[model samples]
Target chain A: MTSSDNTERLVHVPLGERAYDILIGPGLIGRAGGEISTRIKGRKAAIVTDEHVGALYLDPLMDSLQTDGIEAVSISLPPGEKTKSFDSLTKVCDVLLEARIERNDTVIALGGGVIGDLTGFAAGIVRRGVRFVQIPTSLLSQVDSSVGGKTGINTRHGKNLVGIFNQPDLVLADTDVLNTLSEREFRAGYAEVAKYGLIDKPDFFEWLENNWKEVFSGGAARIEAIATSCQAKADVVVADERENGRRALLNLGHTFGHALEAATEYDSRRLVHGEGVSIGMVLAHQFSARLNLASPDDAARVEAHLKAVGLPTRIDEIPGELPSTEFLMDAIAQDKKVKGGKLTFILTRGIGQSFVADDVPASEVISFLEEKRKK
Target chain B: MTSSDNTERLVHVPLGERAYDILIGPGLIGRAGGEISTRIKGRKAAIVTDEHVGALYLDPLMDSLQTDGIEAVSISLPPGEKTKSFDSLTKVCDVLLEARIERNDTVIALGGGVIGDLTGFAAGIVRRGVRFVQIPTSLLSQVDSSVGGKTGINTRHGKNLVGIFNQPDLVLADTDVLNTLSEREFRAGYAEVAKYGLIDKPDFFEWLENNWKEVFSGGAARIEAIATSCQAKADVVVADERENGRRALLNLGHTFGHALEAATEYDSRRLVHGEGVSIGMVLAHQFSARLNLASPDDAARVEAHLKAVGLPTRIDEIPGELPSTEFLMDAIAQDKKVKGGKLTFILTRGIGQSFVADDVPASEVISFLEEKRKK
Candidate 1:
């Protein structure tokens, strides 16, 4: 609608008692303390951030809350995915408990998706359940990771192997934080924006293709574009907060994306989520073509667009040696999609349309990966 | 109610997305696989039991599922409160992931409160959220823990420090399992049953007082009593699943109970949950008297009945030097009741009616505990 409405969009996560809002827009992080304080009654707040984000913004944010006369205690966890482990969760809970955090007090998760996921999951378990807010500071967190109710910690087996879908009381996605990310990191987030169109919403994808530069250049259009993608995700999540039916469509590239992340051992130095997602998207296109769900031309356009935007659209660009097709299938098969031991794949029916294809044989998946490896 | 309806009462957990049914009646656990299979939409099942339960009844339960032609896998963890640590959670997740579990596959949690809590928490974190069936093998789990969607593991800071409110598709409470429990364990479970009455159902407490001997002696009324307690819990949980309002009533004695658990380091041998709850109930009664919210006679009845049932109704009965009022206050301060560092104590106006008294001063709580201690 209007320019004012552009400033915020509320995502209603549907969990009844534990249900919460994902507040998206600029300047949200600053106002988050006051907004969340209302939901948690008069309880004091705890902020869980990484050292990197803490050093840059913690004091300023705390000042914003103190200006509103809100009391907040901050606990800075180590930066990186490694911090999303059980040991870290314990340390955070210890801090919260020692700080005298009650069920009514809130935990504010500040930083990227890893921080948000870890803090939210910790909130879920602290004294059985505590309210939390997400002030996601990275591009990956802003458009994708922060919007969904998915919160978790990494395990020895894989990333997000231990966690819960504990939604935040409110999610504050301030685009201003994106300035802190590097150029490569900024472009990497575009992969998720591109995914909205590939999975559903063809027009948005076309708009992204036209306005990719503006979105990455950090302008008004960039914020607007991200807000639209969030709206699409929020609408889907509101309908199926637990990823039951229509929400499954949102995982267009995640099956491949997760496997890619696992194959790289979740190493940020070699692979960023957005980057893996970009390559995973290309593989999805190939998988769709193999299943006759999309034409070869559609696959080519998908690859061309990603490459043009500086996204890795090829498996070769990925650092690790390709695991056997069977190994890849084994990893994918271990995904939550496997019901009754049959793997469920989110396949595309041309651009902007995707459906869950559960009956697809595992052999087909293995062979498809084999073909991609040979090429 | 007619005879058939008398045999069962279904209380719906109002989570909408994570919503589930609490099936209360006799012969629930044996037929649980069939009832849960319909909700989960899969024939393959995993039964997460503890060694204590597996050695006793896992076979007959497996036979029941196999009879229905449902393929089942059983994974048993060691028995005890300690086995519910992070290490055990990892082991459980590994088993489920390695077994190629899908989103639709059901995990049947079979054992006491520990197994139910660990299994349910495992199910919640494994793949974000999955279908779980609670086959409560203890009086505590059947009456209180199983029905609530709350599932979590404990951290060093406290019991149930890391968890989520993950509801099960079905809660199957078979009275037969109580046969395996010692009298002390059974009495511990009764403390929770008494809580239902202390919070909002005075009539149920009256019923328990009259029938305590019969239920403890293992009469048919035991089945009805357990089912009725679950029905009351389910009704309240369905309305307020998140412990925001009516659900807080369920924590009637938990604040004191948790403090005692922490004081004893969660050693069931030193202080069972019911014994702690019984003592907590006495402490709550004393606080009620001090606040002039309830009669001293009412407090006496609370203590007398607990003692009659072989439960410790006073802190002195606990075999250890009770922590100072300050230490207990510190534990309660970190409880789920604290808001802005102020604690909410659930006090009774009378039996069957309770209100959260958040304005209660921490110093008053200390004085009340000391008064009870001197007595």
Candidate 2:
């Protein structure tokens, strides 16, 4: 909130020392070097980014740091979800250690969810944790992953099965970088922006439904969307930082979303992360209706808005051959949310009324997947 | 301190949700399955131990678990600091993931510091942290490493330069496990026992000076010593679980001790962790005396006691070639204790009086190592 720019807004994550502000604005990343240097003092930093985002922003970021006498080592990894692996994690850690990045130093995660998760994880374990800052460039990361301190690599068994909850010192959700995203990528990120509304802020969903075109046009509305999304996430994180209870509501569609990602072999071309989440969110609502937890009309409304934004809403929409119900069920069973062989899901009573449901039966999930995939 | 049997004592680490008890006594390992089952419920457990300790206690532990209907799958590793690497960490994580260990499942660290550190590190990262209990079987671990949630593996750069502060659900510091330790290893563990007394409890140091032989003999006195040490560590940890300030005092001899360990290539034979601490503690006092912070007589007394206990008190005691003062200083500079290339040492004013000194000149350390090497 302490900003000179009228277009920017800040949402604070209240974790005491680990607490940080998510600065949502038009061009925050360009001026981040000055802000970063002031926060971390003279400590060295290691910037971890992916090739795609690195090509676009690495120079300006490094140049900004230089302007404030804060030297940094930029490591650009191959872009994409596959890059979030143990190998990438080890490489990042080795780079920081070899750089002799002191414990007092900082690690700047300069990309999307993968970079934020990987770098935050590296920062969490390296030297038993060094300081970390998050500069999320994607809507998914800016709205969700980057603020929650849920950092990890995907294992063969499941997504984000190996990780730590490491809060960053600061989060710069720059709206300007989002303008560079491909249309599909931008729509995918919106899946999460809309998700915050589905989870607990139906009014925001209503706002998006009315003014979404402005959000896509890139300006104050986009900033509002991202800042509102961050505020929702920040509130959840502050209430339950570790996802032990209340924070599970944020996974409004993740249980099915992850299973879909796994079933699609995590091939982004087949079903990008946000697309999978899009379909999954719809599935969640439809499944809730099937279980008499919500009305079918609520599910239809969700699907309509997401489709209007050019996001996927069904497994049939994916371009590749989908796996069988059995395969999808297997993936569901492998979800980290599946506690002690029982299904735990974020189910909804109605729109913006999701709740953690731990007693959901596997038989119900199998039948639901079978019915959905048939289309 | 409330116990039905005089031979048993419980040291409570008051970290609120992270709080746990260090249960010290004879034959607690044989009874551990019951205690573990009761505390963690019917949750499955993955017992991680080194081959050396596994050969001695694994079968009995498994038998105990069976008696309690607590199913467990154990992974025994090759023992030593050498095993603390990225490879070992990856393997441990993969095994747990393959086992489908849920976040609520328990990871039992069933060996010394290497096993405890390795297993705890695995638990910290696996599923962003699984519930972990430390059933430490070595005197060094029972008193120190296991109590603090500082779990990690060594990188090629240095020891414990990568890890996290993940508190255990419980710590079983059974004294019976120490009866099987080699004399040198046992003596090495004693260095940490003496360290707590030197850090702040001068009366405890006086008691240790008088009753060390009885402590070596075992039984009630042994239990008392371990319990007291755990209490001291628990107090520090509860006060500052993250090693930010007061907790640095626990590293009374570790700054020098870790340097010595690095010089000896972390060999168990030339210098086990405890022996290094023994010598480091003596060096810390000598340096304090050299700086006119403590009496020379006090430094000599520490040296005399460690020498009497068959622990190394000088660099001359280590076997093989040691690097020059410049070399030793380089090793110290590489220590994780080194903050941005500046020397940070825990210096003593006298017995039972230590403080964290951040501005110790590197030249002074080089000269001190030179003088110690001459002896």
Candidate 3:
């Protein structure tokens, strides 16, 4: 559901004492200091961002924090997925500790998922934990990473294999920041936005399907979509913060998406995270149809919507030489979703009707991927 | 109260779903696998130990796991406080992931506080968290660190400045392991045992004073002392696992102790943790008396008992030139117990009557340390 005012929307994640609010609107970044001061009493903040995001928004954020009498120090690392590593994590943590960011002080993630994840993990660990805030500059982080307390750094073993579930004290999803994103980057994030609807919000999916243009153009539709997506995620997180049960649903497209990302060696030039999710979601629906769990029409509809929004809906659309089905299968097996040698995939009956299907046959997945790769 | 069955004792930490058992007995290392298998369903185990502890116990522990049909791998790190570091944490996590230790699989810590804290932190972050067990070898670890799941690594900033409250599925405190400890190390650990009594159990403290030799000689009294200490710790941990309130009482001697340790640059030659704690606890009592909060007779009694056990009851006994009082006060101010520039120390009204003292004047602490240093 869209906000009544639509000027701004606040989604409160009710996680008992760890609960915080996500503010989605146009100028939250400029007012971040004011918003943060109201919730977190700390006067000191360490804003961790990548060079790209920091270049565009750091000055304003620092000024806004200064305006609210909050002393914030910004640490800008080189932009990219590679920055989410132990070296970067140590760097961020060392910087935070060196800054003497106390337990009650704030650590703000002023970039996208990489920054938010690394920053949150640092905030969680430094001094056992400190107050954290997220100023998500990307739609992907706004709807997903910033809302959940899941934070970590990737190791040579795998992505996000090291970290903790550290929730943020506040999240400022300023829609105006999306204007700085390239069209490709914007569309990539849109894949995750579309994912929220496919997970459980059928009406939201229908609304997005009809108003994709307005969301792309940026206005009330974008705010509503972000607000609705945040609320959906917030509900899931509140119910199961640790991913013991219902939280697995939020990984709807992540298993296959992660496998695809890994198969591509996480090369963003070939495919970014949201692009992989867009293709993976379609594959999930198609595989569900193959299993007779859903009609093929539903899969077609998902693919159509994603394609219309400029997201790659098929594995064949990806650039570069595709890995063999065995290679892809190996990657999938290595995903964190596997438990006791059994495959756990989020399948569906139709749109907005995803369910975690456990013990799915690997042979079927192999066969399905083999067929899809040929397309 | 000591266990009725003095041969072996069980202290259960009842933390709802996070609850676990602490088993104090002889030959627990040999029976480690049997104890682990019953509690954790996973068949794979990764035992993290230091060269010191691993040389003594790793073989028996591995053999036990193998006998139980649990696949086990051993990672023996260099023994020292230095092993509780980011480099070691990364190495351990990489090895665990490389071994494909899944979520349900157990990560067992088979050494003292350093190994337990580092391994527990790795187990906590790897795959978001994995099943953890602690087979604490040293008395300090068995009675204190092992019972409480406060896992962390020391940063350049301070000790235990980075970590999480990740409870273990089980703690196996094999009393036999203490037989291999140097008398100094054993006596050092005894300080924490004494601390449990000093916090709230006057009877336990009185019992220790009476049976000090029997407790150190390693038989029924030793097991009884360890069990009682674990129970006291378990009670506090169950009440406040996160150190929000009453748990601060558990740090009865830690604030000043940590300051002393920091002053000595954590040099074990000068002052190990337990020895520092011994001196710190005495100082705490003396400082309380100086504040007119406790009787001077109580401080004398504490000092006498600790001194009789060969523990240093005064900072002057640290076997080296100590730092200035101002330096120690700086370290204390930098401690995790400091909140909003206010000192929060565990002070006492008398024996077995420790309470969290907030906003204790810095002037009083400096004067107390100044007088103690001269003595």
Candidate 4:
């Protein structure tokens, strides 16, 4: 349905009775007030977002909800990765409880991955979990973070070290917010879109290669691309909502990407999530080649595609001692996907053909990373 | 299957792929060292427990693991409800990671509900959830907290405000450990045993009522009771692990129980979890009566049964301003089972039947509580 300048398309993530909807389109943010007001069935609600997004949209969002006669308040954190820590989560819960948010009242997550993750985690913890809605304002969030039920903040030990698989009752992805993003930010977001192709949708990758220019320029195809990407994510999430088997494939580039973000301090100026993901995908392709799982030509082709879209395909963009092979391997070993001490890596044999390899020994990963470092 | 001086039968919760064993028997604590050594798959492990529990079992438990060549360390917190705060969780994560505990390693939660909740929460957040084993030392824990995948610590605003539903790899319930418990502590554990009946298993509750003296006197049935209770819990969890439906009925007394615990400063000396639950069940029965959903005579019988078993059945013993109706109502509204701002309370329609009521208004609950106070 169209609301003024906004449109809505719902992607259903099948999780049995716990299934949820990812509502995609512009003006979805303003519609959040009515959608949540009707769905949440609570008189009271709280909006948890970062300062930047809150300052930009919190008033309008709250006003729209208030127009529905729903009591709404916003708790904004300083916009950064630091806001995704335990202390920040505790503070959010404090504000929520102080405002007397009943467990039935929805927690609105506004902003990018950081806000969505922290808000979801906070909602998960408060009284062992409360309902929440995701209002993703960033491209990285609209297609990826907003669709998954994964929510958590980082700990000093590592990123997303604390969190849960708490799904949101609804996800409102407003493409209009893309107007605020820079060209680099827009490209950074495509990393995840490309991810779908690398892991499970090679045909989509061909489509992406064909439409990269128009999508980059925010053409009509851009909205459909974003919505379709979310649908892809939603479909996989519904099948493996808890990241048991099929879900691990979604981490095609995340292992390497997360390590890059860790080394680069998770700063947009140095390494946006999308950029790290781009480099990570390249590393995965290279690693696949070193293991003889895929050909070097496959790596070169993927690199060419990312480069054509202005995404980073190399690790040297930031000047930091590429963490020792031991460090990255160790971090990957501690990944959430590890089970019974077996580390599983989501590696691609070719576009749209990825597999989980738990037998990829630590020593082999280290040796492969070392080869890349030497080159 | 035999261990040195085994006095109990270990019935493992058979979740197939998510399987975990429950070690039920006497003198299991002293043998916990060997049991844990045999079950854990890794060498580096962290034992997260509270101060009181640590002082009691830490030395023996660590010595056992060490004997098995498992390098183990522990992070202990002050023994109380407040220790479950986020600050303590951060501390535990820091110490565990500092100990170089790997994702392949396991965490042993040693204590009552508080420790299980805190350690489990830490494990879930530590590298996106690690393997944990519940070594429940108290009867309350052995029968309730240790079996379910529910794990989390509390926040200042409420009890169990921050947590996750992460199950353990094993649950070692050593009945011999109950020998160390105070008379009051021992009785507090029975509150949950009674809950199995209120939820769905009336036969079990009937058995408990018939053998309260034997169960309390530490009869041989004690081991069977613990195992049976774990089995009951397992069956429900396997059917609906995340508490979306029938599982929530297991929270028969928790709505009022949590409110009672919150009113008691989370201090065991004042109001243990079992005691709170005992009183809570009575209130729930009364609430059922107030709504004409159950007979008032059934409420009295439940209270009498609890009193006969040396459990608390009155709010007057809570030693507070009886917790304002609004406060209790607010806490109930913030319960995890709430949906769309409507609180769901598990109310008994008869001695062995319970159903969830979502439309119960706050005013009705307060008036019913006031009438109980007058009575």
Would you estimate the TM-scores of all the predictions?
Answer: 0.87, 0.97, 0.98, 0.84
Q: Name the candidate, 2 or 4, with the larger DockQ value.
A: 2
Share of reference contacts found in each model: 0.78, 0.92, 0.84, 0.72
Computed on C-alpha atoms, the DockQ of candidate 3 is: 0.82
- Mark the regions of model 1 whose C-alpha exceeds 4 Å error after superposition: A1-43, A75-79, A257-271, A286-292, A319-321, A361-375, B1-39, B198-203, B253-270, B286-292, B315-334, B351-354, B361-371
- Per-chain TM-score of chain A in candidate 4 equals 0.93
Q: Model 4, stretches more than 4 Å misplaced?
A: A1-9, A37-40, A244-246, A254-256, A286-297, A319-348, A351-375, B1-20, B30-40, B67-69, B100-104, B191-210, B228-273, B276-375
Full-model lDDT for every candidate:
0.79, 0.86, 0.90, 0.80
C-alpha positional error of residue A324 in candidate 4 after TM-score superposition, expressed in Å? 6.8
Better of 3 and 4 by DockQ: 3
Off by over 4 Å in 2: A1-6, B1-6
Predicted structure 2, TM vs. truth: 0.97
- lDDT value for model 3: 0.90
Candidate 1 per-residue lDDT over residues B203-248, each given as its tens digit: 8788888888877876467776777788788888888876777788
Listed in order, the DockQ scores are 0.56, 0.85, 0.82, 0.47
User: Of the candidates shown, which would achieve the greatest TM-score relative to the real structure?
Assistant: 3
Per-residue lDDT tens digits of candidate 3, residues B1-375?
544555788888889889899999999989988999898988999999988888888888999999999999989999998888889988999999998998899999999999999999999999989999999999999899988789999877777888888999999999988999999999999999999999999999999999999999988999999889999999998888777899899989999999989888888988999998999999999999999999999999999999999999988777777778889889999888888889999999999999998989999988888887777
lDDT of 2 by residue, A1-375 (tens): 112233888898889878787888978878988778777854588899998899999999888877877778989999988899989999999999888787778899999999999999999899888889999998888998898899999877667889999999889888889888889989998999999999998898999999899889887788888889889888989999888899888878888888888887888878888888899999999999999999999999999999998888988988878778888888877777766678888889888988889999889988888888787
List model 4 lDDT by residue over B1-375, tens digit each.
112333676666666667888878766656765776676667788888887888888998888777778888888888876777778888998887777665668888899888888888888877666678888988988988888788777655556655777878888887888888988888888888888877777787778878778677674777767777888888888888867788887888888888877766565667877888899999999888878989999898889899998888988877656567777777777665677666688888888899877777877887877777776
At residue B165, candidate 1 shows an lDDT of: 76
Chain B vs. true chain B: TM-score for each candidate?
0.93, 0.96, 0.98, 0.92
* Top DockQ prediction, candidate number: 2
User: How high is the lDDT of residue A312 in model 2?
Assistant: 87
- Clash pairs of candidate 1? A125-B163
